[model samples]
Target: MSNTIDREKRLHNRTSFLSNIARQLGRTQPLTQVERPALRHTCQNEVMATFSQDQLKDELVRYTETSLGAKAVVTTKADLEATLKQLCLDYCKDQQGNAAAGETIVSATAALLEMVSPQSLETDEHKVHVWDAAAGFDANIKIAERAKVGIVLAEEALAESGTMVLYSQANQGRAVSLLPEASIFVVAKSNLKPRLTQATALLHQKASQGERIPSCVNFISGPSSTADIELIKVVGVHGPVFATYVVIDDM
Candidate 1:
C-alpha cells in the first residue's frame, strides 16, 4: 500500500510539472464544450429540382456550347470512334494551320484504345504518339505535358452547370485531363444528372458503400479560362484551351 502511494505521488508530481510547462508555453486545458456555428440553409432552385432527364440533357448541351464555349456532340456508340477520330484530326492542327502529322495524344480512358486504335492515328511522317495513362506514372506525366490532345471518361455529368465529373486515380490521372492543349471526355447519356446535388448524392452513396474514392474529383465545365487580366477573358490560361464532350447514347 505504501509503495503504491509513492508511485501515485510521483506520477502526480510529473503531471503537475508537465501542466505547468504547458501553461508557461501559453497552452491551456482543453475546453469541455466548443461553440459551433450553425450551418446556413441553402436555397434550392425549383427549375433544377423538377427538370426532366431530356430537358436536363438539352440544357447541358446548350450551356456547354453557349456559356462555357465547349463543343458537345451526341452520337450513337457505333459512331463514337469515327466521330472522335475526326474531332482529333480537326482539333490537333499543326503550327502552319494544317492537320499536323506528329501530334501526341494521351488518353485516360482504356476503352477508347480499342475504339480508336493508336496505330490508326499514326502516319509515316507524323509518328503520332498515343499513350495510355495506365502505362505508368512517368509516362502519364510525360504524355500529359506534351500531348496536344487528351481523352478521358466522365463518371458523371451535371446538366444544369454543363460540368463533367472526373475522379483521379492510377488509370485516370488529373494531368491527363488538365495538362493537355485540348481535352475530350467520353460521357454516357445515362450518366447525365440534372444538378450538382444529384451528383453529390451519388458520390456520397459510393463513399457509403466502402468503395475506393479518388484523391481528387474534378468538375470540368469547359476549357480552362479566366478574365482576371484586364477583364479580358482568356481561354487555356491554366489548362486545356479546348474542351469537348462526346455523349454516347447507346452506351
Candidate 2:
C-alpha cells in the first residue's frame, strides 16, 4: 500500500540521518544510551536544603516581597477563606474605590474551591467565575479576559526565587493566570520547596517512572516584568500587573 511505502521511506530517512551524525562523531552506529557523569558541584541542591517547612515559608514570603516587588501573606487554614476574600476585594476595587467593582476568575480545582467557594464571593457588583470545562475554550477565554483577578492553587512554592509552580489541568486552564490583570497564587506551607532544582528533579522522577507529565507547567515568579526597552525596567509589560501569594499554614 502507499501508506506502508511512505512509512518505510520515513524510517529509512531517519536512520540515514542518524548514521550521518554517527559518522561525524567517529562512531559506526548511534548510541543506545549515555551514562550521566557525576558533577563536582551539588551546590544548587544544597542551598537551603536544611531549612524546615516553616523556615522555607518565611523565606518564600521574604523573597517575594523584597526582591520580586509582590505581596505575600502567611495565614492559618482556618483563616484562609477570609484572607483570600479580603485580598480579592482589595485588588478588585474600581478607580473610585467601589468594592468588588471588577470581575474575578478562579480555577475550578478541588484544592482551591474547597478552601474558598466562589459562591461566597459573588455579589451584585462583583462576579466570580470559575474555569468551566463544560463551557469549552471560547467561553472560558472571554471570562478570563474580562476578569480583573485570576486565582489558582499552586502545586508547590519555590523559596529561593519566590516562584509558584502550576501544573495545568482541564479545569485549570493556562488563561486563568495569563489573561487577568492580577494573579493570586494560593500554596500550602507543606508544599514549599527550596528551589527549582527540586521541582525539576520531580519531573525527572516522573519521566523515569513513565508517568505522563502535565502538558503545561508554569513557573511564575512574581508579576510580569521586563527591562529590555532601553534598559528601563517596566512592570506588567506582558502579563498581569500584580501577583500575590497566599500561603496557607496548618494545612
Candidate 3:
C-alpha cells in the first residue's frame, strides 16, 4: 500500500495558526460559536412579498417561457395525470409518427405515485420506469439512461427565477433529472415560494429543529446551457436539453 500522511498531522500547527489569526482580528482567543448578527440589509424577502400565490405562479410561468426558454403549464390536481401523459407522449414522439417510441422514467416519491401511478401510465405501446431503490443503482440508472423523459416532483418552486428545488433521498436520486433527454418537474401551488429566500428559510428552520437535512439539494431552472465554448451560447451541453415545469394550482 502507498503511504500518504494524514492532513491533520502534516499541518500539525493547527492551534497556533488559529491563535495568530485570532490575535490579528483583535480577539484574545478564537471565538467559539459566536451568535450570528441579527441585523442585516437584504431585499430578498421583500422582492415579491406583496404578490399572491396565483400572481407568483403567473410570474413563474412568464419568466420561464420568456427568459429561461422553458415550457410552463398550469393544471389542476384532477387533470394532472392526463397532462403528464400527453406531455410525455409529445416528448417521446418518433420520426415514424409513433408516440411510444421512448421510455419515461419517474421519481419514486409517494406524492408523485399517488397522483399518477406509473402502472396506469404504462401501456402496450410504451413503458414507464420508476426509480426503484430495491433494484439497486445499476438497474435504476440503466433505465434512466435510456428514458426519453424524466418526471420528478419538486419540493418547492421558486417564482422569481422559475427554479425547481429538489432534495435527493434514497428514493429520489439526481440521475433521474440529469440522464434523460428531457425533464418534467411537477410542483404544487401550495409549495411554491416567492424566491430562494423562502426556500433557504425553510432549510434553516429544519436545521434549527435538529432535523436531518438533505445531503444534496438541486435548484434547476430550464435546460442545461453554457456559453463557455468560444463565448457562443449552447444548450444541452451538460445535461438534459429540454425542461418543462407543470404546476398544479388546485393542490
RMSD in angstroms, all models? 9.6, 5.5, 7.0
Superposed Cα deviation of residue 83, candidate 2 (Å): 1.4
Summarize candidate 3's per-residue lDDT along 51-117 as a digit string, tens digits. Answer: 9889999999999999888999899989998899888888888877676567989999999989997
**Pairwise TM-score winner, candidates 1 and 2:** 2
Q: How well is each residue in 1-251 modelled by candidate 2, as lDDT tens digits?
A: 55546555655567778778999989985567566799999999899999999999999999999989999988988898788778778888878777757788999999788878887877677789999999999999999999899999999999999999999899899998889999999999999999999998998777556566798899999999998889987889999999999999897
Candidate 1: worst 10 consecutive residues by lDDT?
125-134
Flag regions of model 3 displaced more than 4 Å.
Answer: 1-32, 96-100
Where does candidate 2 stray beyond 4 Å? 1-31
lDDT of 1 by residue, 1-251 (tens): 55546555656566668778878989898423345576575444344776766667788899999999999999887787677777777776777778775454645357666566656655454344555544767876876787777778888899988999987766667887788788888888888887788777777666556554677888988999999889988898889999998888776
TM-score between candidate 2 and the true structure: 0.86
Clashes of each: 2, 0, 0
Hey, what RMSD does candidate 3 come out at? 7.0
C-alpha TM-score for every candidate: 0.75, 0.86, 0.85
Question: In model 2, which range of ten residues has the least summed lDDT?
Answer: 3-12
What do the candidate models score in CA lDDT, each in turn?
0.75, 0.89, 0.89
Could you tell me which residue pairs clash in candidate 1? Answer: 101-126, 102-126
